[model samples]
Target: MRSRSTLLDGRCTISRCLPLSLYRARTTRPLENHHGQTPVRKRLNSDMPASTVSSRHFYQNETLLDFVARSSRPVSLRQLAFFGMKLTNDKIIQSANFVRQELPTRMAHRIHDMQSLPYSIVRNNHISYVYELYYHSFNTIRRFPVIKTVDDNDRFCDVLRELLAHHTAVIPHLVMGVIECSDLIDSKRMDNFMESMLRSRISRRVFTEQHIALTDAFLKDPNFKPTEQVGQVFFQCSAADVVRQCDTLARSLTQSSHEGIPIPELVFEGDVNTKFACVASHLRYMVGEILRNTFEASAERYQAMGNPPAPVLVTIIDAPQHVTFRFSDRAGGIPPEIIPYLWSFVKGPRSMIRHHNFKQVPVLEAIVEELETFVAVARGQRKRISSLTSLTTRSPTLRLGMGLPMCKIYAEFWGGKIAVKSIEGFGCDVFLHISKLGNESRFVQMNNI
Candidate 1:
């Protein structure tokens, strides 16, 4: 295989005539542990082993940095490398600060003064750029040999840290399109903004799924060696089981905080067909976040009324290409006034910013000294990354407010989406669509040709 120095010499356009051998090397599915239970399924438990891939990396290794760097647009490698590392680390940190500046602050004005672009041209160009990134990130990583020494492994991680960092940093670039909308409530403006944001998310999901699978493939490759053995056996995963785990977490969380508050009952409906190839951690995080909101809202309502909490119902549906989870809560549908801000990355009135209680958050580092996880787990061994709502991964209270939006990202990033509908004065129904991992990934139809 050609080295990156040789391969990335030219503009790596989506139309470039890349070799077939490279594609084959990068895209092959590694051997999977098909412990045949026919749609194998397992319930999530504390003993559930940490998800080797998804928990550690939100964006996959082969993604956009390399493509954008090699795009016709000029960029200095030194600077590009810095941008790359920043993006990945920012995401792992899920820095509330970056999200504030990049999305919300940018949107505040755009929500009032945004304009439209040449619709087809802008969207398509964005898609074209996305394809270019996906192609380069995946193919480039496939060419590396396994690390055989401690120094090589460290070097590999260091180099990978920078490369994946750049890929990650470029993700919020999708915010650029969304910020083009000024009138968040105007039908046309909303449509365009929603279209841009959703498609950008979909594009992200497509590449992310590629990253998840491809990274797993590489880690599982016999030629690969690392400081530790990340298991190669891919466990069959289940949505119903994950819901149960999240529900359990919700109960524990509510009990701790809302002391006298009734434990909001969480019921999970099982799937007739219960198995899929999936990243268990992502599903767990999304489920945990959604339920956390439900439980918190329910407890808060009761705390206000001096009444008991109502139950939240969870239903799971399994299909060939996807798994759907429905979380229904009776906490009085989100105040109609708050609906508009539902998806935007906004700073809410709550800040549970407790430092050092969890794993030591890296002191915001410079590029030269910077390093790497879905891991806010140093929040230590048992830690879960902060959800869409919580900034510190250690906080189980879910108050910092990135929750639903981040859940939507996690859900959709895998070709799944989370949608919510509320009945004024009554309740809310949230449907989480998880595109089960399998063959419908990457634009094999376009890119492979």
Candidate 2:
């Protein structure tokens, strides 16, 4: 037995020692404080019976279950999902659905208690914890030596009860942690995605500016001849044709300036002009955004460490089903902690370079514009997954913070679907689907900014 302090309503009372596994580490320190007080930490393991006087005291005063039972609370979907995941089987989910369908009543106070927590918090923390716990329990059940059969034990039920008790006991703390996670994820994803978009927009602006400059040179110089140009002069067109094409098939792009950067083997299949509509430019932008982010991230690291430029490998596979692009940078690899937040639009661990002068590109402005394109596509009401033709695509762009979300929105906007897979130490792959619209370039004018 070890000596311990008792707690009630967040206050602690000094008392004679007792032996408890949870309190064994505190034996060396005196129980009494400067004011002759004892600070009792929350206890995890105690051998006392449920009927003991001290146990009763602790249950009545320290446990949050009582507080929740007495209050009017609201339940959230996330908690319900967590509970569902922790429960014995499909029955829990069914029971929750049944409970949810009914109005709040004294008999269903637990549901009400659950509803009291904010939604965002639950996804970030509570859901994550519940998932983690469920996964751990799943592993334990699988590996345990004593298991006679899957149905022989009440292991799942017991763990679920423990989870519920923890939530009820420290509802506020759990809720707060969940909310913090939501905020962090949201902010991070948004920042990273937005940064990627801005970079693409900047690149597009550079391309457009160069195109205009070339046109002016062609007009002013006697030596400059468009017909004699070395490369494929489009294999076609007039300035008017180019402008009309820009309005329709022009692809907004981000690509490596270095010709040596190898393209990796990533591709998609489907009627490109049909599914994406007039959004081909935007789609390309999304793809470019992903590649640019990977390339830039790698390049910046090399620059920081004073290493020579390391080439990135990128590839594209196009078929009747979809268009896919894959990009790989020599910059080590993405860190585990940042993976979940990789495609978010929030600022990352690495900060962007800021210019002291006003003339430089406004990174934030570009991000907002890129994000706007996605928001526009997502906010479209006519879109749905049912409208898309089945297809598969792979690209680094799909991993951009807003890329997948936008791809989902755009695909679904026109009735399509999206999927993604990634190996943290290796790379990421994304898939998108949109109904074939038969090559009609769909364009919506941006409101004059």
Candidate 3:
């Protein structure tokens, strides 16, 4: 009998053991032993405990089409809150079951989408890595037993957290993969694939986090209030405050990188006190990216001219149903050559080359930590640190070329849009439109692929 370590090593080294063509071919076809009997191909994770490994089986009994057909409909912010209100033990169990059923379906759809990509593109190492991660996550979520008690819910939450953390490298890897395979796939097809994957990722996170939050709240308090925010979404999120917070963080990042250079002032105008119901973190990220770009550009222009930086004008328009923020900068406009590929994730020639050459791709957690740390310091939650020095070491300018594209994703997640208009030799204007109704369903794609 083989030792457990030997089995794990074999599983881990299987791809390397076979020729590339044989490995690729075997992924879609089964192998036959000397007796002409097909061997069972179980998807095992060496990282998981032996107990977990023993209980799980490869997804041989299910089909990708079946999982996609079983996927549940997306819920809106209002619906999420409504479900959380009057939370009970039964509700907690229901939430757990919902997540168990939903996550795997979403992951299956993404895996199918990747499988549909050009053969050369899908075969790239980075892309294959992402596919394996999704495949494993799907199997992990789908194999859980039915949730019956609070203890079961707790264990499920742990699984959700683990999977979420494990996926932090997904975006960076996907970016690298797409860049390397740019020649094999068309730009529009790549964008569609990426956008669908990202949107589905957001939807999964929302559902997973919401259930986890509900379980935690129920456990912590003897009387859990339905009105309390049990998830990432905030009901009375202040748009003005979010803008100010992002503005400060972005300015700090810009000021830290450009020492001895004058920093631009941000002048806020119109509807300064508008409050709405939405995800504050998403809003902060979008605003932070826009401000970071504007501030950095403005500072550089002024530093080159040996003059004070021009103030960036931010005008907020609060309507009955939506809120729009317009950013006007005077540093310099985007070059004509770069405008066409501004929102592209796979087409930046220089950035793509840099990404391709990277030994280790940046994870989403590190980026979030940098932004959160600055925001915490600005809010007096943590001791002050050297913003410039910290940012310089942590996140470099345009390191992955993901900010604008990701910002657009977060905005559109809740029915928002980001638009950029640049004038040659002049500054640029960006308009960010966010839905304030909180009733728009999440932008999740189903059978459309």
Highest lDDT, which number? 3
- How do the residues 293-384 of candidate 3 rate in per-residue lDDT, one tens digit apiece? 88888877886776676788989998866789999988789878878888888786566555854434445532334565654564567634
lDDT on C-alpha atoms for all candidate structures? 0.43, 0.31, 0.67
- List candidate 1 segments past 4 Å from native: 1-154, 161-235, 270-273, 346-394, 439-449
Instruction: Give lDDT: candidate 2, residue 337.
Output: 68
Model 3 regions more than 4 Å off: 1-62, 226-228, 353-360, 365-370, 373-393, 438-449
Query: What is the lDDT for 111 in model 1?
Result: 18
Query: Candidate 3: lDDT over CA atoms?
Result: 0.67
- Per-candidate total of colliding backbone pairs: 13, 49, 1
Candidate 2 or 3, higher lDDT? 3
**Clashes by residue pair, model 3:** 256-388
lDDT pick, better of 1 and 3: 3
Candidate 2 residue lDDT tens string, 120-223: 32224333343233222222222323323223223322322332233221222222333334343445443433333233222222222222223234334525
